[model samples]
Target: MFQNQHTFHIPVMGTGHSIDTPIRVAHLGIHSVISVVDDLLCEKIRKHYCSEFDLAYKNIPRSAVDGRAERIKAYLETVHEIVTRKFQEIKELPLFEGNEKDRYFNLLPGSNPLKSAYQFIEHLSDREMRERLIEDLNNKMRPGSIDVNIMAKVDALGTDKDDQPLSSEYSDASAALRGYANSSLSSSLVLSAGFNPRLYSYISDFKDFYRDTSGEIKKKVILKVSDFRSALIQGKFLAKKGIEVAEFRIESGLNCGGHAFASDGSLLPVLLEEFREKRDQLRETFLPMVQSFYEAQGWEYPEVSDEQQSPRITVQGGIGTNGEMERLLTEYGMDATGWGSPFLLVPEATCVDDFTSQLLANAAEKDLYLSGVSPLGVPFNNIRGSGSAIHTEELIKKGKPGSKCPKGFLVSNTEFTENPICTASAEYQILKINSIDESADTEEEKERQKNKVMEKTCLCTNLGTGSLIRLGIMKPTYGRQAICPGPNIAWFNREYSLDEMVNHIYGRGESLVPEERPHMFAKELVMYVDYISELSLLTDPGDAEWKKLVRMQKNLEKGMDLCMEIAESEAYEGENLESLRLTVEKQRMRLADIFQNNLVL
Candidate 1:
C-alpha cells in the first residue's frame, strides 16, 4: 500500500504551472510531483519556504545552497515539518485516548464493550506506532525523504554546446538530472521519443557521483514513458548502465496535457493491459541484465528486495470520474492514477491565474486542441483563446512572426546559420519566412508555408510565466497566457478548492465535473480520430505516412475491441457503457469507410 492517504499523483504541469504545487499539496498528506526545470524559480521557492520553515542552509554547499540544492532541502524540510506536525496533532486527539475508546464502545450497547475497547486501542496504537516510526525514519534521512517527487524531461534538458558542461541557467534534462543526483532530491525522467544515449551517459555519471560521495547510489530514478515499448527500451538502456528504474509511468498519448506525443495509434487501455501482462517478463529480463552490468563494472549492484525488484506501473491522462480512477487502480492493477489537468482548477495546489483558470473553466472540446505551437516541434496541447496565441497572431499581423527568444531552452535548430537559433525566435521565423521558395508553389501553398513557420511560440517563457503573471507577481510579456490543458478540463466547469478536488478524487463528494463528458477511453479515441482526419490532409503522403496510417487503423480496431470487452464487463455497466460502445463502433465504421473509399480511388 502507498504511504500517502491519496491514491493518485499530480502530474508535472509546467516549470511555471505547478512551481510550488507539491509544497501546497504535501501538507494534505498526498504525494505530489513538481517540475525542476526552472532552477531560478526553484531557488526562489526554496528561499521563500526555507524562511517560512525556519530551516538553516548549513548542510548544503555555500554556492549550491542558494540554488537547486537549497530549494530541494527547504522543500523537504517543509514537508517533514508539516507531516510531523499533523501526525502529532492526530496522536493527541481524543479518539486515541483510552476513555474515548470506552465511550465509543458504550455508544454501541449491543457490542461487547471490553472486546470493542480492546480492538479499538490495539488498532489505534498500531497505526500510531507505524506512523511514528515512519516519521522518525524520514527525519533521519536526507532532504528527499518527503513524499513529494520531482519531474525532469529527458528531451528538454537544456541545449548547451556539446563541449560545455550542462548549465543550470537553462532547463535541460542533464542539468536537472545532475542537480538532483548531486543533491538529496529524487525524481523521475520523462522519456518521450525513446531513449537518448547521451542522457543515459549522463545518468551513468550520476551513478558514479553517488558512488564516489555516498559509497552507495543515492539517486533513485524513475522512467516516465508514454508506452510499454518505450518503457522496455528505456528500462533496458538503464539496466545496461547499471541503473534501476524505480517506476514505469504510462501516460495517454493524446489525452495528456503539455507537449502531446501521440503513440502512433496506441490507446491507454491497450497499453496498460500489455504492461500488466508483460510486467513480470520485463522485470525478469531486466534484473539479470542490470546485475551483469554492475558485475562487469566492478561496482556494487544495489540490493533490491523482491518487493522492490519490479518497477511500479502508473497511468495518467484524461482520467475524470472517481469510477474511472478506481477501475484503473483496482481492475487494471495500476499502482497509482495521475490526476493532472483537473488540479489546475485548484488554485491552492496549482498556479493558474484567475483569467486562465476561468478560460479553462469555460473551455469546450474545440477550444482545447493539439496545436503546432511548441518550438520543440512536438504537438502541444493548446488553448485557442490563450493570450500567447493571440500575441503570436498580433506579431504576425505586424510582420513579426516569432518571439524575442529571451530563454534559449528550445534553441536547437541551426538550419539557417552556423549558430543554433530557436525555431520560435523572431530571427529564425524571419529567416524561414524569407527563404520560402514562392516560385516553386502556388500563392496558396506559399501562404500555408508562411503560416506554418509562424505557428511556433516562445513556450519556454510563456508557459513558465502563467502562474507568476496570474499571481500578479510577474508582468505578462505577451498579451496572453499559454496554457496546456488536456481535454479533461472541458469536463470541469468551475474552479474548485483543494479539499473539494481531493474529496472528488477519493469519491467522497461530487466535483465540478459535468456529467456529459465522455469516458477517458472514449475521449482518447475521439482525439485519435481527429488526428487521423488531420493526417489524411497531408498532400504528399509517403511510405512513412502509409505506415503511420496502417498502425493507427490497427490500433483503432484493437481499441474498439477493448471498448466492447469493457462494456460487457461487470465493472462497467449503464448508459456510459453503451455510449462508449457506440462511439467505438462508429469510429471503427468510419475507418472502414475511409479504406473503402481509398480502394475506389
Candidate 2:
C-alpha cells in the first residue's frame, strides 16, 4: 500500500506504449498506469517479465473459465511482486552519487519529507547518525502505486466458442475490474473513456473498494473525467453505492493522446476552473450520500475531515513543461498531474519499439493529427504516417479495404451482421462498401462514404503490436504497428533517459524541450481554436450540430478570456506569457470571422 512520492503520475498511453510502465518506473516512486484492455497481450508480457525476473510462469489460456479476468489477475500480481522486489533492492543501495538509491529520493518533490531527509543526511560525517537516518529513510520510502486503467466503455460483451453471448458479469470491463480486485496490489483503478453503470455497479461486489476497520481503503477508485459535470454525476453514482472516489482525473477533451472526447467546445483551462471552484462540492455532496450508504449497510464510516479526504481533483492531457505543472498544482489546486505522451519518447520508461520510436521523435506538429481511425468511431489522436495507416491505405489501393480482425476486442458494430462485428473487420467493410455502391447517391458522395468506412483500423491488435515487438514476443513485421501520440510529442524530438525526463518535469537542470515551445495552457488554446474551426466547417447553421457549435463558441470565448487573465497575471518564471498573449489575440480574431460568416448563414 505504498503511495506515489512524485508530484506527477504517468497516465496510461495507448493499449501498448505504457502497458509495462509500472515495472519501469514504479520502483523509483513514480506512478504509472497499465492498460488491461488486451488480456492476450498482458499474458504475453507477463511471461516476459517472469522470464526476466526468473519467476514461475503458467500460461492462462483464453478458453479457461473467467480466463480474461484470470490473466489480468495473474499479470497484475506478477507486476506487484516485481515492483516490490525492485523497491526493496533500491532501498538496500547506499546513497551514492549516480545511483538509483539517490535517484529515488532526488526524483521526489523538494517539499517531500523523505527527499528532505535524504538531502540532509547524504553528506553527514557521523557514521552512526548517518546510518540511523538512512534506515529511517528506507522505512519511510514508498514505491509508487502500480495502478491499472480500464476503458469503461470498451467493455465488449464476450462470446463463447459456439458464438453464444456471455452474461454481463463476463463482459470486458467487469472481468478487468475483477482481475484488479483480486490482485495483491493496493492501488487506484482508473475507469476511463466514459461511464458504464454496469461497470460502476459491478465495483460494489468487491470488498476491497470499501474501507476497512482501520479506515484504510485497500483498492481506490479513480474516475477519469473530462469536466466537472461528468465527475459530479459519476461520483454521486459511486457514493450512493458506499464507494468514495479517491480522485477525479480530468483529461482534456480533444487535446489528449487516445480517443479524443471533444466536448461541446469546452476547453481544458475552463474545465480546470470549474473543478477549482467546485472541488469542495465533490466532497460535500458525495460525503453525506456515502455516509448514508455505509450506515444502511451497517458499516462504520471514517470520521475524516472535509478539508483532507478522498476525491482529490487532478488534471492531465497536453501538459508539457514544469511551469505548467506548477500552475496546475498551485493555481488550480490539482493534487497532482499526469504526464503521458512525452514519456513515449523516454525508452527507459515506455515500451515503444525502435522503428516507432524514431517516427515519434522526428514527428512534427503537422504530422500529429486527429484522425478517423478508431473502431470505436471516436476521433483518435493519430500520427500521419503510421505503419497501420500505411498498411490500410495499401489495402485500399489493392481494392481490399479493411483489416482481418485478429483479436475482436473492439467489435461493437452491427451495421450488417446480427452479431456485432467491428467496423475495421473485412466482413463489415465489405458489406458497408457494397451497400454504398448500390445506393442512388452521387459518385463523389459515395466515394466519401466509402472512405469513411475504410478509415477504421483494427486497433485491438495494432495498438499492442509495438509492445510485443519491443519485448521480442513478436517480430517487427508481425503486424502493422500503430502509435497514438499527442501533438506535444512534436516538441520533444529525441529519446530521453529516465533521469533526464524526471529532471525536465521538475525543471532541475536545462529544459529538455526548446525554449520557444509554447506554455501548456497557450498550446491548449491553439488546439481548441483549431478544433472549433474544424467543427464550424462540418456543421450547418441552425441544425442540431450547429446548436452545439454555438454553445462551444461561447465557452471558447469565456475560456479565452480566462487565458488572457492568466497571461496578464503574475507570471511563473518559465511560463512563456508572450506566446499566450499573441496566440489569444490571433485566435480571438479568427473566432470573430467564423461568427460573422455563421451569422450570414
Candidate 3:
C-alpha cells in the first residue's frame, strides 16, 4: 500500500468491465481491483491475453475436479505475469517522451513525493550523481497491486456433471476464493456485496491469511462494507478465525454501481463519521482473539505495533471530481479513495466495447437509473439503452421474455419449480406469469406484479457479454452487454485516455464533468430523499415497514443537518457547496410530503 503511487484505486465495476484492469494499469503503479465473480469470463480473457503474449493456452474444462478454482488461478497468474513484464519494460526504458515511461510519471499526482523527487533528479548538475539517483528511482518503482473482488452473496451452490450437489467448498464464491488463495500474486481479496458465513469461515483454511514469525502476510483480506456495524461484524468473524482484515473499504450505499445496497437511510458522511470515531475498535476488539487463535496453532503472532494494528479505511461512490476526493481524504482521514464509474469511460482502464462505450458516453441523468432488473432482487444501478435492456424489452414485446439461463450462477428461486432456478429464466418467468394472471387481483395490480416478475434479466451471462465483445471472443452482433454504472456516469460523456482521467482525478487538468454537477454529498442526499419517496409510495406500509420508514426519516434529517453545517462552514472552490445547501432545503419539503401523503405519520 505504501508503494502504491496513486491515492485512488479503480474498484471492481462489474464482472467484466474491470476484469482485465490490472493487465492494463498495474504496470503504471496504479492499483485496481478485478472482479473474479465470473471465472468463465476470466478464462476467456486469459486465453486472449495468452495468445497476445505467445503464452501457452490450455483449456480447463468446467467438468474437471475443482475446475473453477484452477481456471481463476491460471487467469490471475497470467495477469500478474503480464503486469510484471510491462513494469520491467517501463523500468528499463530511459526517461523519454512519447513512451510508456513518461506516461506513467505524468499520470502521477504532481504533489506526490516520488514524482517531485523524479522531477528534481532530472535537473541535477552532476552527471554521475544524476545517473545514480535515476537508477535508484527506477529500482524503487513498483507495479501496482493486483487486487481481486468476490461478491459473497454470489456464492450460489454448485452441482456436479451428474446434477448432484457438490460440497460447499465448490460453491461459486468458495471456488473463487480458493483460486485467488492459490494464485502466485501476493495481493488482497476484497469481499463485497455482503457477508457469507461459510465464505468467511472457509478463509481460515488458507495459511497465507495468517501471519508468520517474520512480518510478512502473503495474502490479506479486505471487506467492502456499507456501514461501521457491518464492518465490525464481518471483521470480527474473520478475526475469530485468525484472519486479520487488511482494509475496510466503505462505499456509499445508494450512490454506487451494481447492486445499490441502500443502507437504512444511512448517509455517507454519517457512516464515515461512525467509522472515523470507531476505527480503533476494529483493532481493539479483534487482536486478542486473533492472537489466541495463532497460539492454539503453535504459530507466533507478530507483536502488534500501533501503526500496523489498524486496518486501512477507504471510501468510494458518486465521487466525480477532485474536490470531493480531497474532502474525503483530508476531512474524513480516509487512507484511499476508489474512483469507479468515471474509469468506465477510460477505454485504457476499463473494457467497454465500442457500442456500449458510446451508450455510456451519451447517457444522461435520466438514462442512468436505479433499476430492478437484477435477478438477485437487489436494486441495480443500470443504464438505459444498454444492449441487455434493449434485448429484454424486445423479448417482452415478442411475448417471449426471460433468458434461456445458460450459466445459472444466479439461480436462487424455488417458486414453481422442484429444483432451484433463476427467476430470469424462461421456464420460471412463464410459470410466474401464469400464476400472476390467474390471481384474483385487479388488472392494474396484475400488470404491476407481472412487470416485476419480467424485470429480472439474465445478469449472470449478460454482465460479461460486453467484455467478450470488446475482447473479440464474442461478436458485437450477439450484443446483450449489460453495464451497471453509478449516476456519476451521466456526467462523463466521452471516452478518455487513462492519462487524461488520472489527471482529472488529481486536479492537474480541466475537470471532465460540468461545473453545475452537484457535489458528491449533495447528489447522495438527493438520491436518498428520492429513494425514501419511492419507498413510501410502494405501498401503505404495515406497522413493521412503517417503523422502518420513520427511522429512515429521522436518520435523513440528521444527515441533512450535517450537510447544512458543512455548507455554511467552508465552501470548497469547485465543490458546489451552495447546491448542497439548496438540496437540504429541497429535500426537507419532499420529506415532509412523504410523511404527509405517502407513508403513515
Candidate 4:
C-alpha cells in the first residue's frame, strides 16, 4: 500500500555520522538523509563512491565552512554527473538483459538491491565493488531515479554568532535554499527546524527562479515539525507564499537524536491523533490560502491529486521495534517511520567509528543524556564519558577552557567583543572566566557557571571527525569522537548489517531490540520527568519557570495517560504489559513528585 517503495527514511545523523549514509542505504532502494553542514565532508563523499540513487542533504544555516554554498552546489553537480555517467555505462553491459535489465532499472521490490548488487560484483573487494557498480549503472533507467535533494534547517530564532572575522557566517539558510533553487536538480527540498517567515521569503525566491526556468515549482516542499501546531503554522506560512507542503515530518522531542527540543509533555501518539483528527481542517485551511496566493501572483495553481493535496504524516524518534513501526504506520495512519539511531549501529549505512559503534552497542540507559554541550545553547543529546567530554574536562583542569575554534559552526556568542565569538572557543572562555564577578555570587553558583562554560565541546569538528578518524582518513584534533545516538539506541546491543536492520523494521526475522528497555512512549515520559526534576533545582524560580513546570507537568500527564491506553489496547496484549505498566507508573510518580516537592512549596 506504499506509493514509493521506501516506507522508511534515515534522519541526518551528525556532520559526519551519516555523510555517505544515503549512498549505502540507496543501494537498498531506501531513501536516506545526509547533513551538508560540512562542505569538506561533502567533498569527501563525492571523492569516495559513485551511486545511482537519490541522496538527501541536510543544510544547516550556521555552517562556517569556507565557500559553503558554492562548494555544496559543486558537490551536488559532481555527484549528479558521476551517477548519470555510471548509469549510461550499465545500459551497455551484455549480462544486463531483458527482465534482468528491468530488475536493475527498478531496484526497489526485491530482497535488498544492495545485497544483490554486491553479490553480482563479488570479484571485487566490498569497497571496490560498491564503487565500481555505482560507476557503471545503466543509462536507460527512469529519470530522477538517481538524484540528490536538499534540506534546509532554518533556525527560526536567529543563528548563533561568532566574533572571529569571516570565521562564521551568521545564517546560510537563504544562501543554501538559493543554491539548490538555482541548480538543475528536480529532487525534493525539505524546510526543517521551525517556520521562519524570512526563510519563507527565500523559498519564494526559489519558486520564482524555478518558475522562470521550468515554468512551475517542480520541487516539492516538506515541512519538518514536532507537533500539529508546528505543522499547521509551517503549512499556513507556506500557503501564504503559494506553496503546498508535500509532507509533514513529525519527530519526538526528547526521544530523538541530535539536539533535543522536548515538547511540553506531548506524546507522539497524542500528536499523531491531533493530526489525524484535524487532517481535513489542515488541508481546507491551506488550499484556499495557497490558491489565493497563486491567483494574486497571476499564476495558474498547480493541480494536485487527492493524495498529494493532503500532507503525509510521518514519525521518528525512539522507534525501536518492528511492532512499534507497524503500530505507527497502521494504528496512527502514519505514512512512514524513520529509523535513525539504530542505523548508526549498521556500519554500512552510517559514518561511525568502530570504537564509537562498539560503545553505542554496549551503552546503557544512563550513558545517553541531554547535556548543555551544544554551543547553540540548545539541549543536545550527548553520550556520557565520550572522548570529547574527557577533553573538555582535561582542558578545565589545565586552566584552558574552550576548543581551538576551528571550523566554527557553533560560534554564536558575543559576550566578549563587537564580533561574535563561539562560547566553546578557548579565547572566549578565558575572557568569560576573568570577567566573572566572584564577590557578587556564591562560591557554589560561581563554580557552576564556570564548569558549564568549560564543558562546551567543539561538536562542529568532533561529530564529523568521528567517521574520518575511524576510517583512518583523518586524525582527531580537538578530542576523540562525540556521538549523538538517541535513547532508543540503548536497546540495540550489537552491530547489524543493513539487511538485518531492514529486516528488523519489516519484521522479517527475530526482534533485534533487547526487552529490558522501556517502551518508546514511556521512555519519553521519563525524559520529561527528568527535565522537570532538573528544572526544580532552580533556587529563585521566575514566572517563566512556573509556566514551564506547568507545561511539562501537563504534557507528562497526557503522555502517561496515552501510555496507559496503549497498554490496555488489544495491539499490545501479552507484549510485556507488566513492564510497560511499571515504567509508566514510575514516570507518573516522578512527575507527581516534581509538582509536590518542587513546585508546591
Candidate 5:
C-alpha cells in the first residue's frame, strides 16, 4: 500500500458552482466518461415537466425498420419545433409576473441582461438573431437519434478525410451563443444502443472550443452510458483510438425503468461479472485491430491512450449498504465509485453523517426506499434519490405547473432527546453500545461496550470517507435544460433530498443548504482516508503518526474556518447561499489540510 504521490490534473472547467458552467463536477482520475447527446430534447422535457419525458408513444414503433430513420428524424424535427414554440412564448413573458421568467431566462447561458443590449440589438444580424432564437429553442429540445457515421468521421480526425463530417448551423449557433454546446445528445438510439455518434462531435467541439473556452471558463462534459455493454465496447474502442480523454465511468445500480438496457432485466452483478471476466479479452481483441490499422500507415508503433493504459473505472448509480459496497470493492478491485443516485440522495451517507443514522432508522421502521430510475434513482426514500424515469414520470404526471422546484419537507432540526423511532433511539443506542469508557459499568458489559463503540466509530468514519477516494458528481441536467433556475433548483431539490432530511437535524433554514457540499465533502474525505490507509499499510502502526495527523487536522480546520468565514463575509455580506457554503466546505476538508501539512508524520 505504498502511497503513489502522483500529480493528477483536476478538471476545473464545466464544474463550477453555477448551472451556467459545464455540467460536470469531479473526476475519478483518467477513467472518466465522455458524454454525448443524440439530441437536446432532454432539455425541453425537463423544463416543461420538471422531469424528462419520452414521446415515442407518439412516434412510430421502433420495430418499424423501413422508415425508422425518417420517423426518428421527424420526431426530432417535431421536438425542435415544440421547443422553439415554447421559447417563443417565453419571449412574451413581460406580461407575466413571479419567477417564471427568471427560470426561463436562466436556462440559457447568454439570456440575462441581454449581454449588453447595445451589442445584442446592434451587431447581431437578423439571421444570426433568428438562429440565436432557434438555438434558444433547440436548447430545450432533445435529439431523437445521433448519426454513428458522424462519430466515425470525427473520431478518425486526420485518419480519415474521405468520410466527410457533417456540420450544422444549429450546433454552431449553440456553440457561438452558449460559449459551448454538445455535438450529440442522449436520444432514443443512444438509449437503446450503445455509443451515440454525437460523442465524436462533443469531443471535437470541446477540443475546438477548448481554445476559446480556456479564455472564458473551463467547461465539463458528463457522459452517460445507458448500457454497460455499449459503454464497455465504446470505451475499449475509444481507448484503442488516439483520444486524450479524462476518465471512464461505469455507472450502475440505477433503476433505469423500462426504457434503458440496464433496467430491462439486465442483472447488475451478472453484467459486472461478465465485463470483469472479458475486459482483458476485449482489450486484446481491439489492440491488434488498432495496431493493424496503424501498421497500414507504415507506422511501426502507433501510440494510443490504451498503450499508456490510463483507464479508471468509476462506479456510479446505486450501491447498497456499506457491506454491499465493501463486497463490490473487494470483489472487483474497483478503481473508484461514482456515488450517483445514492450520493445524490444521501450525500453524507458516504461519510456516515448524522442523517445516515436517521436513514438507517427509517429503513428499520419501513422497507428500504430506493430510487425508481436507474443512473439517477435509488430505492431509498429518506435518501431522496430517483432515477431518470421516475423524475420524468413525476414531471409528466404532475404536468407543467408542477415542474417547478419542489420544496424540502419541513422537519424540525433541533436535537432529539426522546427515543424517537427513526433516529433518537438509534443514536442513543449507538453512543451507549459503542462507548469508549468502561468505568462504573459491569466488567463484561464495559469491555464489550468500549470495543463496540471504538469499532463502530472507526468503521463508520472509515466507510464514510473511504467511499470518496474516487468519486464524481454528475449534474443529470445540462445545456438549455438547465437554463431555467426552476429546474435547476428543482433538480437539486430532488437530488439532495437526503440533505433536506439532514438539515432537519440541524434546524437551520431550508434555503441554506449547499448544493455540492455533501457530495464534494464525501469525495475529499475519501481521498484523505485512502491516502492515510495506504500509508499505514506501508509504515509501522503507531499512535504517533495518527495523533500527529489528527492534531494537524484540527489546526488546518481552524485556518480553513478563518478563510471560509472571511470569504463568506465578503461575498454577499455572508447572506448568500454560496458564500455560506464555503464555510461548511472548510470544515469538511479540514482533515485533508492536516494530512497535507504533516505529510512526513
Candidate 6:
C-alpha cells in the first residue's frame, strides 16, 4: 500500500562543505527526547511526545489487571509486542544492514520492564505469528521513531516528602504510575544528577539497581554536573558506582534566569579551562567511556549602543560571543554546545552554512571599521547590530519598506523580533529629508522629521516587551520541553511558537519571571553590563575601546550625558530607559541608511 514511500531526506544544513562548522549543525538536526523530572510532568510530556510520534499503544487485556505487578507485566507485554512486531519486520525489509538492525533490536533487562516483555515474546510458540508481527512492527517502528536520547530531570528524582525514590519506591499514586512507565519503557531514563546534587549521595544504590537488576539493558545516564571541578570529582565517584554517564552540562556563564548580562564579557575562559583540564584527567580514569559536554548558552539583554562596534563580537566574558564553540568542537572534539538562544531567534537556524556566509560578511564589515576587531565581540554592539541585521531580513520578507540588511538579507527582525530595521530605515529617511542641503538651518525640521518617523514605526513602545507578549519571544513552550532563562529573546528567535514558549516559561520549575513593570528586566540586565564594563576597563586601562565603552556606559547609566544632547535633545526620558534608547536606535539606523555602504570604509 505504501509502495511509493521513500525515505524523506531533510537535507541537513551546515554540513562539511558549507560555510559554518558542519558537526554543530548536524547535532542540532538530530531528535532530542526528554523526560520531565516530576512524574505528573513526565506523563504530560510523554503523552505529547507520543502524539507527535504517532506511537500506537494498547490497553492491557481485561484478564491481566488483577494486581500491580500483573498490570505492570501486561504493559511490558504490550510494549514488547509493539517493539518486537516492529523490529522483526524491519530485519526482513531491504533496509536491513549491520548497525541499522542493531538500533532496532533488543531491550535492557534489570529494573527495566521491556526486557521482561522481550523474554515473554521469546517464549511465543507461533513462529509464523512472530515473523508476521516482526514485519508489521518494522513497518510501524519506522526509522525516525526512536531518535531522541531518553532524558530525565534530577529535581523530579528520588523520594517525595517521605524520602523515597519515585521509581524505586512508590509512596504516592503518581510515583507508582511513573515507576511503572520507567520499568516498561524501552528508552533509557536520563538521571539528571546535576540538578539534584543531593541525589549524588544515593548514586550507589541507583547504579546498583540499573547494573544488577537491568543488567542486560543499556543503562546509560546523563549526569548534569554543571560545576567544572565538582563534575570531575563526582564523575569519578559515579564511575566507581558502575553508572555510565553520557553527557555533562557546564553552567558557568551569564545570569539567564534574570536574563541579566554578565560582568565578564563571556566568562567562558574560566569554565573552558576547567572543562579541558577535567576532560584530560577524565580520559585517564575512564578512557574508553563516552565523554560528552554541553556549554550552556542562555539569555542576556541584547547590547545595542552607539559604540561603532561589531555585532556578534566576542568580548572578554560574554557567552555566545566568540568562535569558542567552534574552537571547542575542534579543540576537545566534544559532542554538543547546548546552544538555545541563537536558535530561539531563528527556528530554522539549524542550517549554519547558509547563514555563515552572511555572518562572515557582517563580521568582516565590523572588523574593518573597528580596526581588525570583529563586530560581534564589541562591548555594547550586539543588541542592535544583531537585531537590526536580523530585523532587516524579516522586514523585506513582509514587504515592508526598508533597505536590506548590511548582508543584503531582510529588514524586519520579525524573524526574531519586531521590524526594528523598518523603524530605523524610516527615521533615517526622514533625517535625510530634513538635511535639505545642510545650509537650510533645518535642525528643527530634522527633529520634527525624526519624531514623525518614530511614531509611525512603533519605536515609541518597548519592542522587547511587545515581543514577549505578542510574539512569545524568549519564552518557552510545552512542546519545546526546554527550560531557559526568562522572557528569552534568543529562544523566541529560535522559531518556538508562542504557545510552546509560554508553557515552558510559566510551567512548573521555570526560574524566570517578569518584574511587573516594563524595563525592570532591562535595567537589571544593564547593571550587569555596567559591572562587567567597569571591571574590563580597570583590568585593561590602556584599552582605548574599553575607555570608550566605560564612557558610553556611564552616559547610559546617568540617562545620557553630554553625548545625548549632541545626538538628539529629546533622547533622555526619566522612566523607561529602553523607550528612550528606542529613539537612539532609530537615529543610528537613519545614519546607516545614509552612510552604510560608505560608512564602514
Report the Cα lDDT for candidate 5: 0.30
Cα lDDT of candidate 3 equals: 0.88
lDDT at 319, model 4 = 84
- The true-versus-predicted C-alpha distance at residue 109 of model 5, in Å, is 38
lDDT of 1 by residue, 12-88 (tens): 78666776665565433455666665555555555555566576544343245234444454444454465445444
Off by over 4 Å in 3: 96-98, 599-601
Error of 1 at 288 (Å): 1.3
The local lDDT score (0 to 100) that residue 125 gets in candidate 5 is 61
| Candidate 1 segments whose C-alpha is farther than 4 A from its true place | 1-5, 44-171, 186-193, 207-218, 297-304, 437-439, 476-479, 539-542, 572-575, 598-601
Which segments of model 2 are wrong by more than 4 Å? 305-308
Worst 10 residues of 5 by lDDT: 479-488
The TM-score obtained by model 6 is: 0.35
Give Cα-based local distance difference scores for all models: 0.68, 0.88, 0.88, 0.68, 0.30, 0.32
Model 6 agreement with the true structure over 104-137: per-residue lDDT tens digits: 3331212224334334555677979866655554
lDDT of 5 by residue, 1-601 (tens): 0111111111110111111101111100011111122112222222332223343334343233222223324433433344434445555554124443333322222322432332343345687675565456433322111111111211211111353433432232222212223322221111122354454434433432221212211222223443446655665554344232223444432221111222322233444555566655545554565455445645454333452333333344333223323334445555444332223233322222233223332322122222222111112112232222233334334532112211111111123333111111234334444443535778786865543322211111112121121122222231111000101111232334433432322222453333333222222223333334444444443467566445434533443454344334332211233523553475456545435545555
Between candidates 1 and 5, which one is better according to TM-score? 1
Which residue pairs come into collision in candidate 3? none
lDDT of 4 at 91: 47
63 in model 3: Cα distance from truth in Å?
1.5
Considering lDDT, which of the candidate structures 1 and 4 is the better prediction for this target? 4
lDDT of 3 by residue, 68-164 (tens): 9999999999999999899999988988555888777777887777788778976798999988888888877888999999999988888877888
